[model samples]
Structure formats: structure tokens, C-alpha cells
Target chain A: MKIRTCKYFAKQSVKSIWRNKVMSLASIGSVMAALLVIGIFLILVLNVDYLAAKLESQVEIKVHLVDGLSDTIIGEIRKEIKGLSGVKDCVFVSKDKALKDFSESLGENSYLLEGLEGDNPLSDSFVVTLEDPRLAPQVTLAIKAMSNIENVVYGKEELEKLLDVTYFLRVGSLVIVAILLLISVFIISNTIKLTVYARRREIGIMKYIGATDWFVRGPFFLEGVLLGLIGSIISIGLLATGYYYIARYVEQQMFGLLVISLMPFQEVLKSLTVSLLAFGVVIGSLGSMISIRKFLKV
Target chain B: MIELVNVSKTFSDGHKALKNINIKIDNGEFVFLVGPSGAGKSTLIKLLLKEIDPDQGNIIINGKDVTKLKRREIPYLRRNIGVVFQDFRLLQEKTVYENVAFAMEVVEASPKEIRRQVPIILSLVGLSKKSNLYPSQLSGGEQQRVSLARAIVNGPSILIADEPTGNLDPDTAWEVMKSLNEINHRGTTVLMATHAKDIVDAMRKRVIAIENGTIARDDKKGGYGI
Candidate 1:
């Protein structure tokens, strides 16, 4: 297409949009609303996934050892534990170090543990980190069956609940997104259908004047894209503002209590921006294409 | 040049609009297509424009068989021919100049060329001063003249007008005819379909009259016969 022709199409599209301001506004609003719903859900799914991943990274198993085991026997037990498939690495935590950690955790009440310095009741243990957090339960059972290992401990119930929630959200989000996208396409196209119907006479005239189907459709195609672009931008602006405030509030309220913090607004900005813009353009163009097809028969 | 060889058309419900039409219009001839309601005159014009295909014949325009032309090639063929309508079909929101310029824009004519050609065509149709006025602001004759300006601005070799003056009073209709005549004088083949008996009898152009599904008369300097 020539530069002048592009200018002409742009001019025609803007003119038509302005000419039917009410319809244009309605379509734009609909697009904005649709994208906003999708955006909110998408942000939710993303943050949940991020939180689950953070928790997974921190997960490990504490394998308690039988007391008074010889150093060589402890070495043999470590070797056996290391041989397991899911075990990434294990660090020996001596009873004295465990006692020190417990005292430190007591903070201002550390004086209560002053008499236990020489004789710590904490068991010797191996802090076991795995290659994958999902293997924690199976790895724990294997370690418990090994000789010299008295017990194995992990946050099995919490991990299972978190994984289940993430999986459910992911599948649910996919279904919601698909449905929302279809509805947006329908609404945007219907809005564009009215515009095309209004100017059908002009289209017929252009056809008789030898205008190619593309030529006749150029302005309308551009109209849809413009509407989509405008809608997406507005939605993005509104969503970002709402998200920023919510993120700040969550951060202040939860502080260090949350195992995985809500993702910072800036962290998700680029992806959200790119996805929303792309979504708007694709939906907008597709809507116009579908709407204009029936009228181009002339 | 336009030629229809043994062309025929039947609607889906079995209405035969044209039967074995064989028309050969030479280049630069001014012709009139006359008929009463449902006499197949509109169908014949549509066939010539390649708007509807003849069920069992060939339509040759400028020596190319339009019936065999691919769908993508139809626009290029149409670019070589201009068309006007009884309704004047101007974009109501556009000013007179933009309405004419739209034709050139459709063909992707260069901006400089559009800027040059549009004014000349507008002046030729005597709409130079009214170029800024919208269609609704113009009189019927003036609107028709604007349509005339648009039809010829692309310099098509053939010009087809379907009831170009249908909505106008006789005097206003004559003003539009004068513009059509002026366009014809510039060497465009003009084929107009209409029911106006007086204009036909006075113009003395080559007349092809259709009754029912066939040509009833093809007269050199024909009148609107009873």
C-alpha cells in the first residue's frame, strides 16, 4: 500500500469513528471492559503461579538421625541418602548447631535456654533439599526406611494444598480466558457490523466504481484496530492503577508473614502491557474481518 | 469495446432475465438502453458490468473474456469502466470534491495526480464552485453532476449509467444529460439504461431496446418507440 493510501485509510477510519461517536464509544467501552476482566484474572493467575514457585524453591526435608551414631556410620547414612534419585543435596546439621538455632529463634527469651548449652536435646539431622519439591513426600518415605535415620519431616500437607490450588487456578483461568475472548470478539464485531451496515450504500457505490474488496474494507479494518487499541490502552491504564494500589496495600499488611510475597507491580508490567496490547489488536482486527465479510459481496 | 456473446441468465427461482443476448458495442459509441419495468434492461446492464454472470455465455470487455477472469482480476477490469446511478450515490457526509476524489483513491492514484485530476473533473461537470458542499446541500441536478464528475475522473474507456436522471424533473434531468453528453464527447463509450421516452427521442443516439428476455430493437439514431 502506498503511503498516501495509508493516510487516506487512516483519515477515513477516524472520520467514520467520529461520525458515529456513540457507536464508537460503546464499542470502545465494551472492548475496555472485556480486556479488564481478562487482565484481572491473568494477573491473579500469574501471581498465584509465582507464589507457588517461590514456596517450592524453599521446600526441604529434615531427616532426623539416631543419637550416638559413630561419625563413620553417619557418613554411611549420608551416602545412602545422597543415592536417592530426587535428592539434590543434603547438609549435616549437628545437634549443637540445631540448639544454637533454637536459642536464636527464641529472640529476647534466649536466657531460658542458658542451662542447655553443654547438653542439647535436639537430634542430629540432615537438611535435605530436593531437585523438585513435588518429590518431597516420596523422598521423605525413602529416607525414613534407611538405617540410622530415626524420622523424616516435611511440610507435606501445606505443599499438597498449594500445588492443588495452583493447578485448579491454571485450568480455571484458561477456560475463563477462552470464554471472555470469544465474547469480546462477538461484541466488538457486532458493534462494527452496525457501522458497516450504516455505510453499506457507500460500499456499494465503491464497488461499482471498481474498488477492490480490500480497498472498500481498508477503512473499516482500520476502524476496528483503532477501537481495539484505544480500548486496550484504557483498560491497561485502569488496571495498572488498581493493581498498584492493591499491591502496595498487600505489601504493607502482610509484610514478612507471607511465605511468598505478592509480585511487585513493576515485575509484571512488561508482560501485562505486551499481552493486553496484542490481545486488543488481534481481537479488534479479527472482529472487523468477520463483520465486514458479509457486506463485501457487492 | 464491449461484447456479449449468446449471454443468458436465470434467477434462482426460474425467472429468465435474459435469453441469448448478443450485443457488440464498438469503442466511442454513445448508446441508450431502453425498456419498461422488468424487461431485462437492468439485468443486461448488470451483465455488461460483470456484476452478475450470464448462466451460459461469454462477456467480453476490451477484448478479454470477463466470464473467465479470476475474481481477483475483476477489480482491474472494473477500473477500466465507469458507472453512474439514478440515485447519484454520493457519500452524503463528504463534500463534492472528496466524493470525486474517492474514485481516484480507490485505484490508489498518486496524491499529486488526485489533486490535479479531481479539480479538472469537477470543473468539467460545472461543479467547481460547489466542490465544498455536501451532497445534501446540493440540488438534484448538481448532485447528479457530481456523480458524473466522479464516474469519469478515473478516465474509464466505458461509462455505464443506470437511470442517471431518474429522480430529477425533466429540466434538471436534462442538465444531467448535458453532463453525460459532454462526457461522451470526450471519447468515453456511454451506455445508459433508462425509461425516459423524451430524452431518448431527442438525443438520437444508438438505441438498444429490450422487451421481455430479448432485444426488441437495435436502431441507429433510435427513438423511444411505442
Candidate 2:
């Protein structure tokens, strides 16, 4: 097509959108709403996974040593635990150090432990951190099987539940987002269908006048793309503002008590904008193309 | 030039629209297709336009077999032929000038060519002064003239007008006919289908009368006849 013709078609598309303002707005509104929902779910799932990973990293198996083990045997046991496949680090906590940490945790109640300071009862243990918290059960089992270990604890039940929740969130959000995208496409296409139907006579006249299929379809396709782009940008703006406020609120309320930290808005903003724009454009153009296909047979 | 050799079309519901049709028109010839409402005049025009395929045999236009043309090539073939409908299907929102210019624009005609040719064609159709008027502001006959201008704007060799004056009054119908007559005089082959007996009898052009899916009569300088 000539550059002049392309410009004319683009102008026509913009004119059509302006002419059918009501339908155009409705289409944009639906696209924005759908995208917003998808965006919310996406951020929620991503943040949940981030928190789960942070929590997983903090999960460490504590191997309590049998009382009165020699210093040489304690070193051997630490080496064995560190040699485990998932073990990232194994640091030995001496009985004296363990007692001191317990007294500090008790704060003002340190006086209750004053009589036992010279004769510490706390067991010396190896704090074993793992490369993957999902492997906590296996590592704990390995630690328990070793000689000179009294007990191995790694929050087995809680860690299993956390992993399961993260897996479900990822998969479930994906399915929901896919369905939302499909619905957005349908809404957009149907709205465009009304515009095309309203111009059926015009299209017929064009065809009769020897307008090629592309010549007739080009303007409608452009209209759809523009609608998608506008809708996506607006939705992205709303989502970013909403996410920033929520992240600030969560940080203030949770303070360091909970490990649930949100991903910073700037980190995801670029990719989110790009993907939403792409999705909007694809849905809009595809909708227009599909709805206009039947009418172009002339 | 147009040629139909043993061409036939049967609708899926078992209605035979065209049966064993055979005819040929040399370049620059003006011909009238006269028939009753269901005499298959529309089907024959559609076949020539390649809108619907003939179930059997061949339709050749300008020595190219239309039946063998690919889907992508149909538009190009259509561009070489102009079509005007009974409804004068002008875009209501567009001015008389834009409607005509649109035809040229679709074929990617240069801006300079469109600016130059659209005025010339509108003058030929006697709508020069009304170039800025929308279709709704024009009379039925004037609207048909705009349709004519749009049809011929691309400079197609053949013009197929199906009942171009169907919605116009008698005097207005003649006005539209005069435009077609002028277009023909300029050497574009004109094929018209109509039920307007008076126009047919008055013009006395080459008339091909169809009846019951077959050509009933073909006459040069023929009047309307049952």
C-alpha cells in the first residue's frame, strides 16, 4: 500500500473510534478491567512466591548433640552433616553459647538462669542450613541417622505446607490469567463487531468499488490496536499506583515480624508494562480481525 | 472482453441459477442483460465478477480464466472492472468527492492522480458542483451519479451496472442512464442488467434476454420484448 493510503486508513480508524465513542469506550473499559484483574493476581502470586522463598531460605535443621561428646567427635559429626547433599552450611553452637543466647532471648528474666550459668544444661548443636528448604525432610532424616546426634528438627510440616501453597498459587494464577485474557478478547471483539456491522453497507460499497480485502480491513485492525494500547496503558497506570500503596502499607504493618516482603514496584514495573501492552494489542487486533473476516467476503 | 463457455451454477438447495451459458463480448461493446426477477441475470454478473464460482465450465475475462484465479488475485481482477449497484451504495458519511476518491485510494493511486481524476470523473457523471455534498443531501439520481463516479474512478475497462436506476424516478433514471451512455462513449465496455423496459426500448442497444437459466434472445439494437 502507498504511504498516502496507509495514512488515510490510519486517519479513518481514528475517526471511526471517535464516531463510535460509546462502543469504543465500552471496549476499552472492559479491556482495562480484565487487565487490572490479571495484574492484581499476577502481583499477588509473585509476592507470595517471593515470601515463600525467603522463608525457605531461613529454614535450618538444628542437630542437637548427645551430651558429653568429645571435641574431636563433635567435629566429625559437624563434617558429616555438612557433607549432606542439600546442606549449605553447618555451624556448631557450643553449650555455653546456646545458654547465653537463651538468656538474651529472655531479656529481663536473665536472673532465673543465674544459678545455672556455671553448669549449662543446653545441648550443643549444629545449625544446618540447606540449599533448598524443600529438601528439609531428607536432610533432617540424614542428620538423625548420624551417630552422636540426639534430635533433628527443621519445621517439617510447616515447610511442606509452604511449598505446596507456593506451587498452587503459581499454577492457579496462570490459569485465572489465561481465562481473563480470553474473556477480554471476547469482549473486545464483540464490541468491534458492532462497529463493523454498523458499517456493513460502507464495507459492501467499498468491496463493490474494488477495494481489496486488506484495503477494507486495515482501518478496522488499526482501530482495534489503538483501543488495546490505550486500555493497557491506563490499566498499567492504575495497577502501579495500587501496588505501590499496598507495598508501603504492608511494609509499615508487618514491620519485620513477618517474613512476607513484597517485591519492589520498580523491579516489576518495566516488564509489567511491556507484557500488558503486548497482551492488549494482541487481543484487540485479533478481535477485530476475527469479527471482520466474515464481512470481507464481498 | 468477456467469454463464458458452457458455464453453469447450481445452488446447494437444487436451484440451477445458470445453465450451459455461452456468450462472448468484444472489448468496448455495450450490452444489456434483460430478464425477469429470477432469470439469473444477477448470477451471471456475479459469475463475471467471480463472486460465485460456476459449477462447471469456464468464465474468461480479458483472456484470463476467472475460475482459475487465486483468492488473492480476485481483488486485482475486480479492480479492472467497475460495478454500480441499484442501491447506489454510497457511504452516507462521505462527501460526493471522497466517495469517488475512495475507489482510487483503495487501489493505491497517487495523491496527485486522485486529486486530478476524482474531479474529472465527478464532472463526467454531472455531479461536479455537488462534490462536497454528502449522499444523504443528494437526490436518488444524484446519489446514483456519485456511485457511477466512484465505479469509474479507477479507470476500469469494463463497467457492470446492475439496475443503476432502480430507485430513481423516470426522469432521474434517464439522467443516470445518460451518465452510463457517456461512460460508454468514452470507450469503456458497459454491461447493464435491468427491468426498465422503456429505457431498454428507447436505447435500442445490444440486448441479451435471459429466461429460466438460459439465454432466450441475443439481438443487436434490440428493444424490450417478452
lDDT of 2 by residue, B1-226 (tens): 9999999999999999999999999888889999999889999999998889999999999989999999878888898899999998888878999988878877888889999999999999998999999999999999999988888898899999999888889999999999999999999999999999999999989999999999999999998797
Model 1 Cα lDDT, one tens digit per residue, A23-80: 7888788788888987887788788778767877878999999999999999999999
- Stretches of candidate 2 exceeding 4 Å from the true structure: A1-9, A52-61, A67-122, A128-147, A153-159, A293-298
After TM-score superposition, what is the CA distance of residue A111 in candidate 2 from its true location, in Å?
11
> Listing candidates in order, what is each one's chain A TM-score?
0.77, 0.77
Give the range where candidate 2 chain B is weakest over 10 consecutive residues by summed lDDT. B102-111
lDDT for A21 in candidate 1 is 87
- Expressed as tens digits, the lDDT of each residue in B112-191 for candidate 1 is 99999999999888889998999999999999999989989999999999998899999999999998899889999999
Which runs in model 1 stand beyond 4 Å of their true positions? A67-124, A129-146, A154-161
How high is the CA lDDT of each candidate model?
A: 0.87, 0.86
TM-score of 2: 0.86
Residue A284 lDDT (model 1): 89
Worst 10 residues of 1 chain B by lDDT: B44-53
lDDT, candidate 2, at B166:
88
